[model samples]
Target: MEPIDDLVGRLGRWSAGRGPLFLLLATRLRQLIDDGVLPPGALLPPDRRLAGALAVGRTTVVAAYDTLRQEGRVVRRQGSGTRVAPAVPTPGPRVAETSNPLFLHLLDAPDDVILLSCAAPLGPPPELTRAYATMTLPADDLGYHPAGLGALRTAIAGRYRSQGVATVPEQILVTTGAQQALSLLTRLLVAPGDGVLLEAPTYPGALDLFREASAGLLPVAVGPDGLDVDAALRLMERHRPVLAYVVSCYQNPTGAVLPPLKGRRLVERAAALGVPLVDDEVLADLTLPGGDGPAPSPLAAYEGGSGEGGVIGVGSLSKVVWGGLRVGWIRGPQPLIARLARLKAVHDLGSDVPAQLAAVRLLAGFAPVQAARTRALRTGHDHLRAELGRLLPSWTCPPAAGGQTLWVRLPYGDGVSFAQVALRHGVAVLPGRTMDALGGSGPYLRLHFLLGPEALTEAVRRLARAWEEYEPQPAAPHAVAPGAVPAIVV
Candidate 1:
């Protein structure tokens, strides 16, 4: 049995984040269990004893324990009391082994290493700073806004409406980021053993989340144009997935934009099949110079205003404005939005109020911000491509129309092993396997062009060195055809 004093000590600063007290307690307890600090089958302190030690009400402790029990993390009986659940084999990668290298760097990284693993702006734009400067908060209202501030929600809805999606404020539910929006939707729609349709080389974060839910992943190939709608529909009809997630515009890793005709066909088919489609448009606004005119209307635009069939659109400012700003939203039917808001409230009560206020201002004057971002991105993208072509001419690096990454196919070896070599050579890159659901992208690597020209050049030099050191391995049998993965022209 874990000692009450030691357990309390392990849960240091647990109450720092917002949300219900029980949720905070449960979150801390979950961490301890996952870390094996509280070993499997270890008995926990009685609710009253823990409550007394943590200086909280017994009910809070009880609710926390109940939450854990619901997650199957603990087993409780009247006579035997609560004990940590015995370890069991689970689907997908362990929580400790995050697929995104950015997370690993966040925890710890060497100072000299050039990070090409995560594709994000180097710094917040001037517009973000200006937005923060002029932002004001409400004095009379309590800060909590589970569904987000009304003004911000209105702004988000208006943005969607302007893009041809007939959205109202009632359809918007603001979340911490697109990541949380996905998490909340997964909780609501996906159950253990349920099937989820995903693009083959999708966002690593989404793959991680679905895997954590123990959802069976169905991988559909995505090319330069976008998701293989025919393959996706065939799988939907055969497997009847509970949910389908797609990055409709400027997809992560691949940087593929779904053609408008295909987008319409996909939503229409998904509606007919009764599968809730989640359109992740976090990268939609990241259009580079000399690329496609503008990202096509969001997937929701294809689904009529009836809102009966699910075509949930998720958007975020993390990619366009800044990652630290942490403002994102979900556009769905009114009922779905309302339910998601309740789920979000249980997680964080609400997103940062000041951030929401600033987001409103940012959206109001977004033209210049977007223009500036695309210009910088275009420069970075061109510079990175040139360096790669000159330094490692053998590798097949396709040009992306938009988005931060370039999906490069290795000349011979797999990405997983080469990634380790790249890290040792002072550059970090994401292995294609981590982003792939079926491990068919072994011959590929997703490299970001977010760094400055000098840094990108240095990173490419490091990668070239790593390539020389890395021994060539025979291509994996499951590797997809290089011809199928083309660059996004528009």
Candidate 2:
């Protein structure tokens, strides 16, 4: 049992946020539970006693206790009062693999629900259409190049060279998409119970993959300028992680671009630690109109020389061009690439030949495609931000210069529970808890701005209605000053 004064001291400034009194208290209690400050079987103060201590109405403490009870974090008995619940055992790999909201949305896409859960381009760009039109096949070829087609490999290596990372065709391996690239690397590097370091509040797909592999996830904080290199290095020395994954350019949910200096330090430290680092750059090319020129060169570029044996770069056409094209590649050392190719052969023999041919042409003429993408993304991003501000002003939505999604912080209630209310109102937004390995992003949501202006307006309107219904209105609403809420850098 925790002492009431001690618990009160631990929950410093719990009422600083703009949420309902109950929700703010509940959020603070939830954090304590998650941080193990209030361990399982620890007794909580009585509702009346806590209300007296905090100087709030007894109803507020009751509601807060009820919230934690509903989440299975606490147990309340008729005579004994409330206590923290025992930790549940981790689910099996099969069950954990498909537990993400992204997969759930895909499996059961209800009609009429505006899906802001998945963040992929709507369709192929005009350049992709033209590439398919000009795609050619050789009559003499069997097309079983498991390491990717020769022309496509060459094109990818050439592209790397242009970006200041020296590369050769042998260092590139084509996969179905960036997801497959991540899967292959996880299979090659991580064993059951091995530590795999990554960013907190990262891409949900990657979290699903790591959980499926049964790897112990070591999460480092990511900020506006990108990953915390010093903290990552400390974790590496402490945990000796087998593999480290980072979305260096235009990070998935947060849209943070890693500075070159941090990228250099990270790869250098990882290399010294003999940790295989996978730099996921799928969203790198989707730089918006107001972004700082282009995204910094791939993390591999910072390693100098051939960039072999240190950082592995993964890129895809899915984000910059179209998801249907299904073209992605991995750039690594020749030996690693060769080993991955053999592993890939057992899966699908090789990627689709026609798609690779088209990718080659697309890469040859990518400047125009990039220009078109950035223009559309800029419009969508601005429109979504404007609509969110106009309709749901209390939600803190930081401006993302690039990438498809916005990481939003709700003013009051947690995202997981509120998302259900949002869904009932005909919209599906991803809760930030799904993206977090430690389940700490309770008040955040990942909302993609891929929809056009009209659709975005509708989505925000539905979300506003959902918020109004879900949150209890106080007699006098508190006004949050502009920038009062800190941005949640994933």
For each candidate in the order shown, give its overall lDDT on alpha carbons. Answer: 0.81, 0.81
The candidate 2 region of ten consecutive residues with least summed lDDT is: 481-490
Q: How accurate locally is residue 447 in candidate 1, as Cα lDDT from 0 to 100?
A: 89
TM-score of 1: 0.78
Q: What TM value does model 2 have?
A: 0.79
**Pairs clashing in candidate 1?**
none
Per-candidate TM-scores read 0.78, 0.79
Clashes per prediction? Answer: 0, 0
- Tell me, by TM-score, which candidate is best: 2
- Give, for candidate 1, the lowest lDDT window spanning 10 residues: 481-490
Off by over 4 Å in 1: 1-102, 306-308, 471-490
Tens digits of per-residue lDDT for model 1, 171-288: 9999998888898999999875677899978888787677667676677777878899998998799778999999998888798888889999999999999999999989889888
